[model samples]
Target: MVSLVPSLTEAVAETLPGTLVGATDWCSHPADLDVTRVGGTKNPAVDRILALAPDLVIANEEENRAPDLDALRAGGVEVLVTVVRDVPQAFRELARVLTACGARSRPRWLDEAEETWSAPAPARPRTTVVVPIWRRPWMVLGGDTFAGDVLDRLGFENLYGTHPERYPRVPLQDLVDASPGLVVLPDEPYRFTAADGPEAFPGLSCALVSGRHLTWYGPSLAEAPRVLAEALRAVRR
Candidate 1:
């Protein structure tokens, strides 16, 4: 099998080991993963992937492009495209994809992740927050996104959660005008850092978070809540 999504690639590599014949360069987890590198998620080397002759290629609607997957399909490679918008959907789709890939049984980490997130959240006043994924044009997390759901479950309300666009590009002034209680910045997609993103939001709190834990749905799910909660706690203080 070949994986196009980094999270799913980690999932496959960790769960099935040598079954992953090829994976994109972005699949960085399980650091020692010694699979054939097909290239990046958005621009995979189709010819290299075709040469591997993988029976199945795993992809996500958000992380991969249609043309690339279609090209693989045209080459007679079966492609499984997954759509994960929330934690529940992530669990459900992971189960489906793993089963379809002939998993002997459910991975224990998946169950642990479910249990970890399923536990009741402490009742607290929800803090309205704006989570920025990118910064050049200033894009933020919006409605129906996994990160938004994760934060909502943790008693943090996304200020832009109702926006029509999934990751809406808004002006810096508009974000400031919204007057969110906090600004959450992740270290991927844009690499927002302590010295970088926080400067923009002056007095308001800004949380520097891990992009993998915030958005990935693999084994990272088990630790995401804790990792994110710690980050939020520090920012909230």
Candidate 2:
């Protein structure tokens, strides 16, 4: 796998084990796979793929850097891009994409993982979560983003419901005044960590979470829901 934007790349590495390669600034996984270091607007690793010459290369149309993708295509590579927008689309596309790429998915991984979230009970008071991928100034996920859908499924509402765009940047003061129940900093975009959460957004309950679990819509979805279920439980406390 040549993943310039992380997310599903980490999933492939973590779940499939030794199956990932060529990760960028966005990827997060165990340090076993021989990853090509490419990040911060410099893709030094694209030159490396020519000799390996694999059977298939998978990418996301929206996330993977385009120039590098074009370079790969120029090398007579068969590139298949998966653009998954929602949870249902995510699951449906996974099997087809994996099969197309000749990758076998473990049975029932998607359904079993998604089922980890109990149906939201009226009894469980909702937690308003803000999934911040950027916070230098501040950007939040709004409705219509995959992350927003994930939060809804996990039994929470986006505090930035009024924001029009899927991913919008706003002022930090407003975010603070919104008084989010939980401030979730993603591992990518902003790459916020557990240690960074409180220092970044002081005076709010915060947690660090896998951005891919909430945003990556691919075969990774099969495993992400369980990761989300675990995070949701923790956020509720």
Candidate 3:
């Protein structure tokens, strides 16, 4: 199997080791993963992937480009494209993908991840938050996003959750004008840090979170709630 999505690569690698023969360069989890690199999520080397001749190629709608996937399909490779807009969809898709990979039973980690999100959230008022995934021209999590749903389940409301675009670019001044109660910054797609991102919002509280925990949907989902909640709490301290 080959995986174009990083999270899916981790999922398949953990569920059934030695199952993957090829994966994108961005597949970083399981740190010691040894597989043929097929370039990247957006621009996978189709020739390299075809040469690997994987039985299945796992990809996410958001992380991969359609043309690349089409090229793979045209090469007679079976492509399993997944759409995960929210947390529930993530679990459902993961299960489906694993089942397609020939798992006789659901993986234990997947079950644990489901249980983690199913538990009652600690009693805390929902704080309005703006999540920035990028800078230069600021971009934020808008509506129908897995990360936004994760935060919503954790007792936080995304300020731009009603926006039409999933990830929208807004001017810095406009983001500041929104006046969110807190700014949640994940360290991926842009690598926002304490010194870099927080200074943009002088008075607002900012939480520097793990991009993997905040955005990934594989084994990390099992620990994301605890990791993310601690990061949120740290800003309060």
Candidate 4:
């Protein structure tokens, strides 16, 4: 099997070790993972993937390109495409993928992750914020995104959750004008840092969070609530 999505790669590698023969270059978790690199998610090396001759390939709708997946299908490879717009969908898809990989039983970590999120939310009032995943042109988590849902569950209400675009590119001035109570920045897709992102919002509080914990929907989900809540609390302190 080969995985084009990083989170799915981690999930399969953990659930059914040694089953993955190839994975995209972006599959970074389980840091010691030593699999054949199949380029990237958006522009995967389809020829290299076909050369590996995987029986099945796993991909996410958002993380991978349709044309690349179609090319893999045209080459007679079975590709399992997953759609995950929110946390519940994440668990369902994870379970579905693992089951497809021939797991006789659900993985313990998946159960633990479900239990972790199923617990009641904290009593704190929701803090309205803007989550920026990229900069330069400036893009944010907008309407119906997994990351946005994750934050929503953590008491951080996304200011742009009603926007039509999933990841909207907004001008810097517009973000500032929104006047969000806080600005949540994840360290991926753009690698926002303390020095870089916080300066953009002079008066607003900024929370620098792990892109993996914030966005990934694999083994990391078990501990994401604690990891993200701590980041949010640290900024408030």
TM-score against native, each model: 0.97, 0.74, 0.97, 0.98
Per-residue CA lDDT of model 4 for 66-92, tens digit only, reads 999999999999999999999999999
Q: 106-209, model 3: which lDDT tens digit per residue?
A: 99999999998998766878898999999988999999999999999999989899999999998888888888888998999889987889989877888999
- Across 52-123, the per-residue lDDT of candidate 2 in tens digits comes to 565556667666668877887899876767676566665655555556544576445555645544345335
What digit string (tens of lDDT, one per residue) describes model 1 on residues 1-237? 999988998888768878898988888898999989999999999999999999899999999999999999999999999999998999998988888787989999999999999977669888999999998899999888988999998889999999999999999999988989889999987899888898998778888999999998999999999999999877832
TM-score of 1: 0.97
Candidate 1: Cα lDDT at 150:
90
After superposition, candidate 3 runs with Cα above 4 Å error:
none
Candidates' RMSD to native: 1.2, 3.9, 1.2, 1.2
How many clashes show up per model? 0, 0, 0, 0
Q: List runs of model 1 lying over 4 Å from the truth.
A: none
Worst-scoring 10-residue span by lDDT in model 3: 228-237
Clashes of 4: 0
The TM-score of predicted model 3 comes to 0.97
2 versus 4: better lDDT goes to: 4
lDDT of 2: 0.65
How displaced is residue 80 in candidate 4, in Å? Answer: 0.1
